[model samples]
Target: MTTLQWTPRTDAPRALVVRDGHARLGPAQATEMFLPFLEQAGFEVQVAESSEIYADRAVMERTDLIVQCVATSAISDAALRGLLDAVEHGTGLAGWHRGIADAYRNSSDYLQLIGGQFVSRPAAPDEERGTDESDRSRCYTVDLTDEGRTHEIMAGLEDFTLRTEPYWVLTDDLNDVLATTTYAARPDDPWHRPITSPAVWTRRWGDGRVFVATPGHSLVVLRDAHVRAIIQRGMLWASRPAAAA
Candidate 1:
């Protein structure tokens, strides 16, 4: 990743977002958009393409938030363990879509740390890289959980429709699910079941707060007014003191 150009507010918190492995997701658009988004929220941001960013213990210690938007299998065990240690000691961990949960598929330490894993999804169509709106992703709805209605990060957010990948996520009992989506049976994925999976969630890894929004496969979805708000709030929410969580 090249150096991101953004002015920093001295009073703002620091965030490190790692962008690595992504299948069909647009890393370029995501990278381009997220810089201004986090900076505008008062985050002194560092963007790295290497999963090895996890190993920079000094950076991890200074960072208030760590957002990994990388591939599922590219991160190393040492790096994962380093991140896990940092978060346990106080760093916040977060990711949009596969960047958080889907990362480190073979490492139980990574999965255990994040509290969820990306099991599978509706088949993503092949594409030339583009924004979410221009791409026209498969449509789905995002509905808040009962608890989400009053949740500070979700305050004023409501159920909304989006044209994006409706993930069929697998989660553990530890996840505090905030929002979800129901996938209707389709000819392409016809089953007797109408699956409702977590679209947004927050969980604790020791004292470290963790947030995941599994809806972003593009800048289009990520750039949505609601979704962008959720991502910003989610990162800020996680960065707060654990006692407040």
Candidate 2:
């Protein structure tokens, strides 16, 4: 998982890459993809398999940004406080898929920091499972908001379709919805019609910025040239000293 071909920036931005929690959710896989991308994109990244990074004041202080790929995990009260203090003071926070939105279901403070929470998958009806739209594979389209089409993170990226999980999330208006996906009620689904959710977005936590992309459940979807480019830029921007847009 090490590829040093990509050079770091002359003044490299330091990033703490933290990943731990649900395996099927792919924190490891995300680290595998993101670490190399960060190195090449000119970031000096520190990898952490545990949530301890949240409590390391020295590390949190010097770190320019945090890329959290963790899912459904808990942090020590102190660690959560420290992480929050750091972010409130301006350390950027960014993540993708289940990493940011779906992690720490019980941490309301954490949920507020990210401005959203993963509720249910809005399962399509299934007689066997007795629920509809429960993580079934389906086609979803990501359409950019007018702002998103020209935003720095999404610049030059066109609307695209991805076949993946349409995560049913509960988010407030605080999030500047960047891109969204629409899902029609298949005959098997519970709803008789369609529904849409934010596919990509950015939010603010105190002085810090939060960037998230909600549609990366599998490699085929995440590796798409457009998707990769957007994430690369988002990660870079989350940290300071990013490459020019």
Best by TM-score: 2
Q: In candidate 2, which residue pairs get closer than 3 Å at backbone N, Cα or C atoms, i.e. clash?
A: 9-42, 123-132, 123-133, 123-134, 124-132, 124-133, 125-132
Question: How many backbone overlaps does candidate 2 show?
Answer: 7
TM-score of candidate 2 to 2 decimals: 0.85
Residue pairs in collision within model 1: 21-70, 21-71
lDDT (tens digit, per residue) of candidate 2 on 54-143: 887777767778999888888878778877877776678888888888887777898988887767675533432334534576665789
Candidate 1 TM-score, C-alpha based: 0.82
Worst 10 residues of 2 by lDDT: 1-10
Model 1 segments more than 4 A misplaced: 1-12, 123-137, 186-191, 240-245
Q: Residue-wise lDDT of candidate 1 within 95-193, one digit each (tens)?
A: 788777678887877788777776756543334224654544566789999999989879998999887766788888899999988866655665666
Clash count per candidate: 2, 7
Instruction: Write down the TM-score of every candidate.
Output: 0.82, 0.85
Whole-structure CA lDDT of model 1? 0.76
